[model samples]
Target: MAFVEPGVAAVEARQADRAKIRAVAAGRRAVVIGAGLGGLAVALRLASAGWRVTVCERYGSIGGKMNQIEEGGFRFDTGPSLITMPWVFEELFEAVGERLEDHIQMVRVAPLCRYLFDDGSRLEMTVRLPDWLASIRNFEGRDAAGFLRFLSMGAAALELSRATFFERSPWERPSMADLAALRRPLPLRTVLPYATVVERSCRDPRVRQVLNRYTTYVGSDPRRTPAMLSVIPAIEMLHGGWHIRGGLYRLVRVLGALCERHEVGIRTGAHVERILTDGNRACGVGLRGGENLPADVVVMNGDAARLPRLLGQTTASAEREADRSLSGLALLFALRGKLDGWPHHQVLFSGDYSREFDDLFERRRFPSDPTVYVNVPTRTDPSMAPEGCEIVFVMANAPANDGDLWDVSMLGEARDRMLARLDRAGLMSALSGADLVAELTPRWLADSFDMPGGAIYGANSHGPRRAFLRHPNKARRVGGLYCVGGSVHPGGGTPTVLMSARITADLIGKYERI
Candidate 1:
């Protein structure tokens, strides 16, 4: 295999040498845009492979959404509080001959999360399988066996998919074929339907709602999500969920340090205004300050939908017009005192979950009553908050952007409504008279991370086609351009994004070796 420049025009023999020179030059310089987890991982992987790698981040900090903030003696990790599949981090460290445990201390939580119902009933879902089963039995009698059966199916699906689908580059379509042929796998058709698992295993509406919420972790609705998602709980319960000693943000810091150790050049506050192109082939990137940083390969870790603007023109396969995933409306409250009744992580579902999903994904408006996720890291890590206080991240799914005009008055009213709802649901009583130290909304996330319309996950997983039709790892038309992130292959969440990075790295490594 030889290096090929993307988008080079055909020329006569007289100009062939010039084209070859440009192609070789393009193949030697690799630039990674966005210093998020995916970008950092790729930079580290490429650098370890002896490729000159440079990572550019628009924000002053390296972590994109995973960045943290300190306000009035309270510290909060602005995004992604949960950490799953600790091996992913371990792999990145091992790639550079280091151990993650040396960089960051992680503690596994027994009850990964707690769900509180409107009627004051609560269920603590633990990482211990026996404990979780007991909780299920307590909530809905005789449903424990059914839940176990559902988990078994999910485990099988996860095993099949993780080995075959999650580890390969999306650019290598035939890679999947080769793996399938080698393994002689069962078709996805053999797996149980997602809807059947929920309906059969859960008898109570609340129990069903609690189980269904897991789908949202991957940006899918449980009703529409494939039964393959059942593996999520199995992985969580069996393998366990972890909480980093300081905060989840510490993981980003550790990754950044690992990249530095590998001699990967990292540039913060340096934005790529445009991708420098030699005809259709990406040769390098032009920074915001009008400086040109040449690259042989370019990997985008930002939102895939926004790639066209950065590239300065749309490629043949750039689907910029596609509808995006639902964004979130968040309220990060730095309370002056601890939340009395709440656990480390809690989900308070609305009375009508189906209606809420429909409104956010279909009606394109903020749900009248939204299912809320409340995360208080201080419960596990006292360092996050001052003595006698806590940091709470309250989030609910909202329209990415409905083109509805937003006003300060409307936002204030919405906050009031959300606070009232929390009080009414008995999820939080501190909000009634507590002093707020910090608050963030969708607008903040958009402005800070450059996420279009503040959409968290790039696209929704609604239809079966959409689930399989996610953005590929490599540009179908542009050579030397690749994508690796939440918006790309293997889908969203901490573990999946790390998987995407690994797949992209392996592809780039193979190409370099050839």
Candidate 2:
């Protein structure tokens, strides 16, 4: 009554509530280093679990590689054009009391990806299995049995992945029961190498090339990357590849907004110079500006290849130390014409698939005949382009920046070759007078994304253990130091990175420090 003497009671009540909130925060503080998708996801997740979370990103803007390069009235998503698993993003939003659909409008890609072989053969992988199968049969003249077998292989791996590899602790090895669930051709073939799977399942070289390209999703070298990666194609076929109505940058914006709604503090341009530690236990982080922010738990959403240095250690375990994954050479073109007849995603296979892999993984040189991945986002989201114009994100799997090979001269040469290859493949005829908006080589990726050598997917799943034995979400040796993102298990891709974020959050719950 009497206006409570100009809101004196309300002020006191607010002070009391603030005291209680501070008391609760005293025991829980989390510092997420990076505002990438993984960092943003985990930051919101930790905040949802009552942790006072702070996300520090070196870049002025968030999203990391999942960003946009806007120029010449055209907008392009820099990475990950396809959304194979919408459920992952839905879960992310659901956990934060938001609906993914409310923030993002995604339309199912009718044909997930269109594949073009060296022989000018074309196959459109459609959302409907019957349609895809018909196209395959029409083009390759292959029986459904071979296709069924390949799908089965992918399904088996997917089943096992969801049950064992994805859900389990990265620090733990699979049990016999886990192996039983896999129920594959054999143990030797399942996890050992890709050669066995290729020899058995991939019969037609064109189909094989298409299937082999799936490994490149995680930046794995299909020639040496384990057969477990066969799950990728199945994921696309089963889960369905959806494209955001705007761009992936829309998701980034929504994620950042959700973090804000949850009261998670995100500071951009906060470069973590060092991860302060106390005998393998993370103490806090030292910002580049000589600022120290102490935290009870530290989640690193950075590329884990830099983990050892972040911890100020010389080396990582032989088992945990993974080889960096393949990098990419991206060509973002601003063209003055609408693109028709091209799916949202297109893969033009190389003439010599093995030689291409050899050039990328073995010789560490640009492939003479590179498998070109053309992404026309404007096809689905027309707003991405101007009137009568299209924005194209063309990519080629390239070697990681090895020995500074991607110099200006070298990149120019690679670009010329890429244009020639595109022309030869009949893809360049679509672009008679196209403007090159931007070219992001591995060198640019490494410099921009903190990805060592611009290894986009983080670690190459080479050898037997490489696929399954990636750097764990929970650092085996360090306390209060956890990792999530493309660099760590359970591997890269938008969905897998989200999975890693989920796993790291769970691991943090079970972490002894908290």
Candidate 3:
């Protein structure tokens, strides 16, 4: 054959393939397994695209990890305290011809987090450059410039990622814009490990700890995480952290509403036992009680590691304990009286940050001196509590190992360690008359979400390949099967999960539609 331009030939081939896909009418069915944010968002998108959609959730309520609890007039969000990249969410509403502002209010939280160091020193981290730089100068005058340079590098990574990684799966054909982004000169820091970059960029250990904490946002260890993951902090510094008026769970409610408006059906207490396939292509699902629901396409919103079990494979494809991400132990408190002088979010650092990660990832146990994170949602929204009470959420990172049993005694020890960290920061006294409403241990996360070891974001984003080469949205060996949510491509977080849904819906439009 005579040589033709490669791009042109590829376009011709895609066009020919498109012509072969038969057009189906409006009644084509889609089954979404799980009612998490990603599942609900894709269900809304497909339903809006004229395909009938049904979402089956194993739990009685929607919002998998992004759940909520209300007791004695106090409400606490179980997962994801705040959201950044608000525009990512806005796009989803815009896609379905709805306005996000009309449905929910996004309140910007100033001084995103209050960091309490081991020596009782406190600093407020904000997006306002002048104020933050001034604070940095007070702590370590030389680090101010380094901090700016680090953030600058992160901005570049975010720019490149938006053009490529965030747009589509790695297996898909890249647009010219994506290829152009790839050609751009990358920062030297982007090639280094995240922890190494942080240590090199800051003189003070406190600042390094603050910057290093970003890696844990995706359930990764900073020492091994790739430098491109710097985008996490860059996003927060650029867009500012936001909280819905009610709670982060409000986002799930808004997504559920959008799905309902598009005529999508949501079935709770419907456990999908297996993914039913016909001749290697996903046709529907088998419920736990043996009810078979047929559909043209199936999307999994649970942990990607559980896909094989649901497909009836003899051997498990679950991530190994060494490869799994960190899980958290959370203690939700409902205080009896008013507690002032606390921000919406605070991080109490451990004396030795490196050793803490060693305990979490290597020792495979809760840290002996674990860093504790405290979030008092009532600080931002008083409506979350009673007139004089507040809801306090205290959490610490723990290993996501399957064999570990977080029994009552184990939970008590973890709680004590967490409270001790808070006490050192002088915030524990406020909980003198508090009620411990609930505790979410790693075992609870594993059992409740069907996640292996309760690995929140599936595999840890360690090396470059593992960080970027995530499970694709479309399954290669299984036709008509797709994956979405925090565990899949584009990775986790509220905004990224929504992006995953958008990408999955577009792929279905391409391969399953004419």
Candidate 4:
């Protein structure tokens, strides 16, 4: 999948870009940087529209964060273990003359996740409302109805999501008429911090704590994350959670295949050093090896923080301006035995949730008592693990790659502290004998994924207007330069990233007055 290089490849690249935009244009071409999930979706969309799309990935394989790690016959998906909204993926296939059911096998994950609190009480949040109410009704009492009412509000919010709010490009500042169409009042409180809404609806302290963590999907502290993001509950509880058979990477494989099927040329090991531009319009990109790849449209699926450097222009970084989101310390283990009490997804929450966030975000230090997310993929996909062995993925929220606080030398000590948290949570005995496959730090994530500061969702979604804080889908100054990924509008997570691609691709088709 290497980009064809040397003397003539550069010449042909220039000609192809020229002919696409200038000629009869049936052979219009698109060049995509970074073949991550968003890039792959964009490529497929463009290819389906009769554009000659070329996706160049720096990684050896596609699937940026949706990477797979195999160790001692056990397989683990490094990023995004749970599939929240299946319809998003299905719609992607439907757009490209294919059906998702034909490509991937999916199994419903009942009892979506298990939440273990600091107190000895643990609650299993099921996809079915009856089962969910059965568990929480005791603590929530009459207020269980309030929780249901909150979800109804979230479902109504989805109507706005389908319109301009989520579908419209971030570059276009919405007018008063636009807000009217959304039916939101002036000076929108919908963009207010998520804590305001959660505190009003949730009666139980534990329920509020679990709901607050949903803000991490956009890599924001609960106190700062927007209330519009409350739809996360409806997305999981109503639609249900699912796991792709084989592994989550299977989706990436199918996407790559779909791109190829549509004649979208994919190149591996080609990293773009700079985006080549002709005045206001982007004409091409220059690879690290000094190779030029010209294109009519350049879709950068990389981090928005890299935009200034890639353009060779001096501009303020969206990352530096906004609070960068929290990063993670991931520990993958290959264990021979299984624990008696385990769910597909488990959250062993910290005793003091607010202090944990303060430690990570405000103090810029590791959490003294962190909420740990333990995922057992083998619960549904047994084939991922050998005979009796299981692959365990343990993730704890930590500060991003702040220059002073995090470094490789400190990773060992951090891993010990994380495992100690597990011990305190009462699951250390099961993992004590497991073989450690890898210990990854934020710096490693930064280098590996090209994330500036290794911040998971790019910018932290804080402040009064979370909408204006995120990077725009299209560059304000640079024409023909577009961005699609977790960092852009609609926020982070697999479904939203895919939605960004859909939105960006649609915007690319519209002609703007200069």
Candidate 5:
């Protein structure tokens, strides 16, 4: 659907209404920089709440990492093909008095994903708990019970963490009271200490590898990622994975339409040169082309780490230290023919998962045998491709950018190695005779998204400190400024970014009220 910009008359009327509301001390003028998912969500919510909102996007299109690339007769979603937590999107639509179902069609998948182990063993992880247990039983009989026990523990941990950790705003550090509440919960205490959820869940190395893979969803290393992340799978298993019709990028289009419906102003291709700060307060932003947009509040939907640079200031050492998260490398391909044997989602594990991660985090180099993720959207939605064609998204974790290693030679070699690895894993046979489609590398991600080091999720989800040590929503030194994105609070993923937007909007609402 084409985006319909709000009419000038409607915008003026909304402004007049907001002015009247402000006269009664009820509203504020807000500007959101970067029309990424987080920024778009925040803008929609605030506009729905009677605030005069404007969204500025540097890119020609919205979606940030969740962008769509079209070439020839093929189209591919560049980032985050999977959608979980449908309720988050529903909430946004509800805020605007629209139903999510009215705009986007979502289909829930039964077998969440199929995992191919290095030893050639395959396991299909299902959304149904019993089916998942059955798969575990098929692999290791008695271990099946242990798997169920583990999931039970994971479910409890999810509840505790979601309530205590995920719900709160990242701007305010949790006090002794918060810590005390977290400690009082048994499941939280049990899950909090482990380096990896798989460590406490199973004894088999393969099982550990399977569970450890969840850490990658947040751009984290299982060995160092908090155990609380086990809830990730718990939530997915309980709620199920969803596929949005017409690609997930349609979400951005729908949201952009919703923003217009609420009279929120959106400006595309508007690069923000610097955040305009009034002494210690951010009053607005300066455009690269010399246009200055004014507002009482500024919400940044770009990478949190880039905030200091955008503000034309050196990031504090503490701020820099707190911002280490996982970055990623992805390869999106538009194939000429269909792959018969592949599922919608597939995960291929390396022989030595631990050593592979060690190569990444410890040595800061690409792994010899990196775990590979393949997403064949055509498996579920044939319309995404030509009559018999397919769209494939291949991805793996790689070093963001260290300045010297991102040379073309290195990138080309990495791409060749990945394709070869897929061939060795039996994927190439399925796509035999299929034409080579478009290829997007980490460099493309960096160039397109303006993310430092091509990192997908801001910092690595390492220790508990990493989880709680996110960049604050409100700047510590700058007033009238806020950040909402994967680089900041609630962390990465589509759902989390949406939550970050809600949290940021709530903060803005509270600030305006005060």
Candidate 6:
């Protein structure tokens, strides 16, 4: 199905309604910068509570990174391909008085992903507990029990996050959940980097490597990210990875419909150049066309790091670059024929995982032997491609460096490196003769989204400080200014971004009177 673009007629009607609303109280008016998932969501939420919200998107469409594109009769979800913690999505719809099941069909991805190591050994991760344990036992008898213990630790952390971390803002005073989570002594494992924890838990190098790969969910290096992030795999393995029937973009479609239903104004291609402030308070936003949108509350749904610049101050971005998360080089291909027996998701592991990360994070360059992620949504949802054809998404981590021009020479070199890694896994032959549909580099992301260096998750969750203390939902220095999205509090990923919206909306209701 084609992406559901916001109707021009509907947007103009909403814009007219917003003008009428402005003539009234003005106290309930909210201007949201960037019509990303979080921005659209919070706008819907506030509108439900009698707030007149107008979301301005720099891009021509909504959903931001959670977007879709179509080329050569193949539909490609350009952003996140997997969905975990399904309840988070359900809750968002329920909050807006809609049932998620009624709008979208979610299918559990069986044999979640296939892992291919350089040594010719393969493992299929499944949600079936018995089969998964059996695979571990067959691969490494000792690791079966070790893997369970590792998951148990992750479960504990996830449970703690549900109450304290995910539900409330970090700046909020300790609630009962926060106090309860702190009642016990902190585990020593919590302080150790995730890689160390993984090494201690899994005896097999392959198992440790797979476990370390979870750190990339938050765009962090495994050797440095805090162990609390173990919750990533725990959530995926326990709740299971899922795919929407048509495509992941279906979720964005439903969200857009809900936003429209709730009478939230959505203005696409409206670039906000500056967040107009009155002394210490945000009053509205100035669009690039010199059209100033006035409001009582302004919420930034773009990169939180860009707030300083929008507020008319410059930052020493070098510091941000040093602390930025890893970006990715994505190549979308439309293959003429399908590869039989291919799984929905697969990982081609690099021979030297540590060295690959060093190249990406420390050396600030693409890895010569990069680990590649291959996602063939057609394996599960054939509608993603034309009949008898397939769409393949290949991605590899790259340094989020502003210096890399990603010119033709650079892109060619990166593509060759990715193909080399795939060839080593003996899968390149299947992809031969495929047509490259589209490509995304860090530069494209940075330029399109205004994110610093195109760091997907804003900052790397390296040490505890970086991991726990992200950009807050409530802007510290600017009154009536709020923030949401992957870069803000509670951190990145689709589910967490929704949670940030909830927290930000709640904060606005509590602090600002309608």
Which candidate number maximizes lDDT? Answer: 3
lDDT scores of the candidates, listed in order: 0.73, 0.78, 0.87, 0.78, 0.75, 0.86
Instruction: State the lDDT of candidate 4 residue by residue for 317-394, as single tens digits.
Output: 355623788888899998898765688889988889999988988888778788899989897788999987788899
Instruction: Estimate the Cα RMSD of every predicted model relative to the unseen true structure.
Output: 7.7, 8.5, 5.7, 7.4, 5.9, 6.3
Clashes of each: 4, 1, 0, 1, 7, 0
State the lDDT at 253 in candidate 1.
88
Segments of candidate 2 deviating more than 4 angstroms: 1-27, 139-143, 173-188, 314-322, 512-514
Query: Is 1 or 2 the stronger prediction by TM-score?
Result: 2
Two-way lDDT contest, 3 vs 6, winner: 3
Per-residue lDDT tens digits for candidate 1, residues 374-482, read 8888888888888988888888776667354446875776676567668777655666555565566666767888877777778766565566557888777777788
TM-score for candidate 4: 0.90
lDDT of 2 by residue, 429-506 (tens): 888788988899988988898887888887788876777778788877778888989878888899888978877776
Q: After superposition, how far is residue 301 of candidate 3 from its true place, in Å?
A: 0.5
Q: Report the lDDT of model 6 for residue 399.
A: 85
| 1-514 per-residue lDDT for model 3 (tens digits) | 1111124443453333323322342568999999998999889888877788999999999999999999999999999998888878777776677778888888889769999999989889876878988898889999999998899899999878877788778988887856876998879778789999988999999999999999999999999998899899999987688889988888888888888888999999999999999999999999989899999999999999889989998676545799988899999999978777788899999999999999999889999999999999888899899897889999999989999899989988988999999889898787988999999999999999898898888889989988998889999999999999999999989989998998888788778863
Model 5 Cα displacement at 508 (Å)?
A: 0.9
Of models 3 and 4, which has the larger lDDT? 3
Q: Candidate 1, residue 216: CA error in Å?
A: 1.3
TM-score of each: 0.88, 0.90, 0.95, 0.90, 0.90, 0.93
Residue lDDT tens for model 5, 365-476: 7787778888988888888888988888888778765452557787677777677778878887765565556566666777888876677888877777776667777777
Give candidate 4 regions above 4 Å deviation: 1-25, 173-181, 184-191, 315-318, 404-409, 467-469, 512-514
Query: Which residue pairs clash within candidate 6?
Result: none
**Ten consecutive residues with minimal summed lDDT in candidate 3?**
1-10
The runs of at least 3 residues in candidate 5 whose Cα sits more than 4 Å from the true structure, single-residue gaps closed, are 1-27, 173-184, 188-197, 318-323
